[model samples]
Target: MNNTSTTTLTMKREFNVKPEKVFDAWLNPVTMKKWFFTLEGTNKVAQNDPKVGGSWEIVDHRQGVDYRAIGDYVEINSPEKIVFTFKMPQFSELEDTITVELKELGQGSEMTFTQLIHAENEEQWTDADIVKALDEMRDGTEHGWNLMFMGLKELVETGKVSYQG
Candidate 1:
């Protein structure tokens, strides 16, 4: 039998937009290409099938490397919640589940992004290398998500993704 544990990470953000708008941005291919996993000058290709059991993919071509993020929808409650499986095959074999919950607050929306990261193959819990790698992976995932959120904010609020003061 394999023994593994899951580490959960949750992040919250407030956006100056309606819950519907915020939720739709996640499934809209055009909007996703503009912000999701995209760098300033990189080309992004996004394809989203926004239904339960539907699959989605976003590929960012940057620095001559194509980084792909692909996933399948688990649950999608319009303007409320979304759950999907996330994976980046080139980087790691680890597949994680991400849940995004959105609620209307006043005239805007508040989003809670939760990610469940599963521990890899049967490794000793006391292994330093395993601990270190997990820590690094957690940190990197957080940083990447933050960057995407910033881009989302810029695009949803301004209809464009150029850096602003």
Candidate 2:
């Protein structure tokens, strides 16, 4: 067995927002902050450029601690695909990259996300372990995306950019 634990995980949700708008939520910080956090109490500190070779990092401070994921965009196909690396202490032994793809579903959009996770060895590749990991990642991703979509739909439909709070 290989040391790399690459499970091509995917999830799809048809959102009530245009593919371009959904895509912009990812590229823009104002849109990203509304949904990207693991919890609402956390403060999201982010600076990113939504293009290939550009930086994308978010630091979430909650309670008295900080969690961060910093990486560079490997590629970007506007309103279609986004690929970048990921790392964190709270997530996993994450020396990997996650690629997010958006497909226009009629007037809305569907998102497909894949994460290439790195593990120490095959001993940690049990079905139970991997399933648990995938589940955590999947649920978190879907939840975050849902929040983002809702926030984005509100913004796009209302033509509001700045946060009231």
Candidate 3:
């Protein structure tokens, strides 16, 4: 049986950089490692093959466990749009899709990111636990993405990458 309930999260940010630069940061392994897994522990592996049908993977060592995130690119429209299927081994039952659109804004760029997440079974869990898990997931996702964007912005606008998060 599969859970029919889904969650969609959307976020937008404006960067003082060109769309190409912003887009490159997402696919380039060196730049991506600077921001990709900021929420969890250190990233043990980061690799990306930025093309339609190509795959990407990241492994993060958190505490004593290794969490692996794998994804396949579904669409790549240059500096304008990207779509991918994302999966995390820690949440093996759920499969998610992420879509990112970048629009040129004067001399800068604005990016819109949307993620659709299908949650796993919750039958054996209490309502409060489910709610709490959802809340934590939302907050953690938001925080992680924000930090990544900040890292992107800093790298693009100032040519510096800080791993403070």
Off by over 4 Å in 1: 1-5, 39-41, 119-129, 163-165
User: Considering lDDT, where higher is better, how would the candidates rank from best to worst?
Assistant: 1, 3, 2
lDDT by residue (1-165, candidate 1, tens digit) is 555556777899999999998898888988888777765367467898999999999888876789998999999999899999998899767789999999999989999999998766454546675667667767888998898899898788888888421
Deviation of model 1 at 156, angstroms: 1.0
What do the candidate models score in CA lDDT, each in turn? 0.83, 0.67, 0.80
Best by TM-score: 1
The C-alpha RMSD of each candidate to the native structure, in angstroms, is 2.7, 4.3, 2.8
- Local error of candidate 1 at residue 24 (angstroms): 0.8
Per-residue alpha-carbon lDDT of candidate 3 for residues 40-143, written as tens digits (9 for 90 to 100): 23778889889999999888776778878889999999999999998887768467899999999999999999988666646677766666766667677887
Model 1 lDDT vs. the true structure?
0.83
Give candidate 2's whole-model lDDT: 0.67
Q: Residue by residue across 1-165, what tens digits does model 2's lDDT show?
A: 445444554556566677788677777877565545433346467678877889877787766778887777898999899888877757665567778798877877787877665554356468777777666655665565566545555665565534322
TM-score of 3: 0.85
TM per candidate: 0.88, 0.70, 0.85
